[model samples]
Target: MAKGVWIVAEQRDGALRKVSLELASTARKLADQLGDEVSAVLLGSGVEAMAAELGKYGVDKVYLADNPAFEPYTTDAYAQAITKVVKENDPAVLLLAASAQGKDLAARLVGSLATGMASDCTDVKIVDGKLYCTRPMYAGKCYGEVVVDSFPQMASLRPNVFPLVENAKAGAVVKFEPALGELKTKVVEIQKEASGKIDVTEANIIVSGGRGMKGPENYVILEELAALLGGAVGASRAAVDAGWRPQSDQVGQTGKVVSPNLYIACGISGAIQHLAGMSSSKYIVAINKDPEAPIFQRADYGVVDDLFKVVPALTAEVKKLL
Candidate 1:
């Protein structure tokens, strides 16, 4: 029988991502409930030092695959390494982040391991020693619970939805060497964002714009406010479609799903597609000229006014508080 809870920990540029710690902490809770140990599969070059960090979050063991080929993250290389580990030590439940990389890898693992998986889960709990995952359905209109009956139930959790906890453990390391007989894909170049902007999915606060923004230049105001609040600027699908912002900044069903602590929607009419992405925000504030805008219905606070005037005033108030 599968006995231990496992997580595929993610790291980038030699530092562990916040989602990895979230996965570790969540796995710790589930493992304790099941009376099992929590283990993590860490794959990257020069990432052996990160094992101690995972241990601080209640992971008892780290299966280290320290190989240069693991860096730059090719789907083929990671799938081979992770599949080998899971096959060697069968885990009861496997948890991963719902980020771009996690989603890609989890899909491949499901095919290779022949197990069931829940994608982009917002919540997960162990009921009767089984994993029950909660995920949004039909553009956030409803939620459904998922259970994978197969051994080593897999789930990819959404980023920032789960809390991080520190529970120290032994953090023992077990080195594993994967026989990767690969020759399929190669990382030629990686183009990174020049502005070092925060991803909306992982941000605590988001100040977003839409058609009311008028033009891309007006986004500077939102950026100023976001900088002051240590948040990020997001755009609606309309803004992205109009070329006012990059697709990466878009928040909607066709774009990225965000669950920030606070979401400030400016000038956006709140189309169902857009609402489907960010409706799960803890607090939503909508500023629009039209009082009947659909976004007002979902916003916790609604301001019936022009966003051009409202955003500047709001920025001033934030500056005063700072």
Candidate 2:
């Protein structure tokens, strides 16, 4: 029988990502409820030091697979490595973040293990000794509970939705060698965003714009406000389609899903596609000239005015507060 809770912890450049901690913390909660130990898989070059960090978040053991091939994160290499560790341990529950990398890895792992998986889950809990996952459906119109019947029930949780808690444990390290036979893929190069820019999915607060932004140059105001709040700037599909923002900054069903503590939508009419990406935010504020804009229906707070004027005034007020 499968036992214990397992998480595939994600790291970049030898540093653990915030989602990794969230996964560990969530696994800890589920493991405690099931009276099982929590173990984490850390794959990266020279990431042994990160094992202790996972321990701080309640992981009892860290399965370290340190190799040069794991640094760049090829799907094949990681899939093989994680599948090996999971097969060896036979964990009852497996959790991963729903971020881009996690989603990619989970898809491959599910195929490799021939197990069922729940994707983009907002909440997970132990239900009658089985893993129950809650996920949004039909573009956030409704939610559905999922239960995987296969061994090592798997779920991918949305990043930033789960809380990070510190519950220190032994954090024992168990080194393992991955049998990755001749790989089919290789990383040639990686283009990254400008230094200090945060991904919208990981931001605690987001100031997003849409077609109301007018043009790319007008994003300066949004950027100022976002910088003031120590948050990231996001764009709706309209904004990205209009070439006002990069694809990475787009937030919607066709873009990136974000669940920040606060989401401020500027000049956005609140299309269903856009709502699907950020409807999970704790609080939503919408700014639009039309009172009947679709976005106002979902916003916790609505401002019926031109975003151009509203954004500048809001930025000034924020500056004063700081």
Candidate 3:
């Protein structure tokens, strides 16, 4: 039988990613409910130091697999290592963050283990020793609560959906030696986005724009607001599909899901798809001319005025404070 809650902590260039720590905090919540310990699996070339960091998030065990081949994020290699760890540990629940790398790794792990996987989950709860996962379906038109009957209920959590908590634990590090076969695919090229900004999913504040911005030329307003707040910029699918924003900046069912503390929606009409991505935000502020816009329904604060006039006013207020 499965025993504890396990988080697959992802790392790059020998450092743990923020989403991994977020998952650890999330796993701690589930672990508390199930009366299970929270353990983490970290695989990278030189990441033994990250175990202590994981421990701060309530991880009692840090399973370390250090190897050079694991640094570049080969799907097959990560799957092999993760599968081996899961099989050996036999966890009751396995949680992963729904980042680009995480989704890829989780999909392969689910296929390799033949275990049930609930992807892009916004919330997790334990009822009667079972895991109830809340995930969006049909482009966020509706939500589905799933209960996995598999021995290890594997799930990928949407980034920033859960608040991060730092609980101290004297986690013991365990070393593992997996016989990783030759990877079929090798990542030879790497192109990094040139934004000195934080990862949108990890940002506490997100300023998002939509079609109401009118054109790509008007995006500077949104960017200015985001810059003043030191937060990341997000875009609705409408703006992304219109080529005004990159897909990476998209926040919706077909895009990345976020749960920042403050989500400021500027000129965005709240579509169900867009709402699903950001409804989990702690506080939502909507600025739109249409008073009856659906975005107001989920917004904690709303402004019924033209964005051109309102955004500048808001920006001025922010600049004065700065």
Candidate 4:
């Protein structure tokens, strides 16, 4: 029988991603409920040291797959390595962060292993000795719960939704090697965007701009506020469609979905598609002159004023707090 909760840790450039720790922390609680251990799977070249970091987040064991071929993310290579681990361990549950890469890996692994998987889960817990997962459906119109009866049930936790509990463990390192024959796909180079910027999906705080800014240059205000708060900058679909912001910075049904602790929307008329992406945020603040803007309907705090004035004031206030 499958036994223990396994976390497929995501990493890049030899460093672990924040979602990895988040998954490990969440797995600890679920494992405790199931009377099982939490195992973290770290796969990358020269990432053995990262295994030690997993121990800090309540991981009991770290399965290390260190190899040169795993330098940059190649779907075929990673899928082969992870599929081998899952087949060997037969973990009771597999938890992965719902980042772009994690989503891709989850899809591939589930197909290969022929197991059931729930994607973009906002909540996951053990109920009646079964792993119950909650995920948004119909573009965040409603949330649905699922329980996979199949062995090795898998789920991907939405980034920034689960809180991390800083608990330490021994995190015994176990080295493993998988036979990955030459992969068909290869990553020649990695072109990074917004170097050193916080990942919007993973950030706790986000400051978003929309058509209210009138032009892309006006986004400097949001950037300043986001910088002061150690947050990331996002944009509504309108901003992206207007060619005022990059698609990567867009948040909505057609773009990246985010669930930050604090989400600030400036000059945005919240369409259902836009809200679908960020409605899960812990708190939402909207600034727009129109009182009946759709964004105001969902905002926890609303400012009925032009963004030109409100943004600068908000930025100044945030600077004071810092």
lDDT of the candidates, in the order given: 0.93, 0.94, 0.88, 0.90
C-alpha root-mean-square deviation, each candidate: 1.1, 0.9, 1.8, 1.2
Runs in model 4 deviating more than 4 A are none
If both were scored by TM-score, which would come out higher, candidate 1 or candidate 4?
1
Tell me which of candidates 2 and 3 scores higher on TM-score.
2
Displacement of the residue 28 alpha carbon in candidate 4, Å: 0.7
Candidate 1 runs further than 4 Å off: none
lDDT tens readout by residue for model 3, 1-322 = 7899999998876678888888998888889998889999888887899999999989999998888878788888899988988897799999988888888888888887778988988889999988999997886677899988896899998877777799998668999989987678888998888849666787889999999988899989888988899889999999999999998899987887888999999999999989978888889999999999999999999999998998889899999999
* All candidates in order of TM-score, best leading: 2, 1, 4, 3
Q: Higher lDDT: candidate 1 or 3?
A: 1
Instruction: Give the C-alpha miss distance for residue 117 in model 1, angstroms.
Output: 0.7
lDDT of 4: 0.90
Number of clashing pairs per prediction, in order: 0, 0, 0, 0
Encode model 2's per-residue lDDT on 206-301: one tens digit a residue: 999999888999999999999999999999988898888999999999999999999999999988899999999999999999999999899999
Off by over 4 Å in 3: none
Q: Which candidate is the best by lDDT?
A: 2
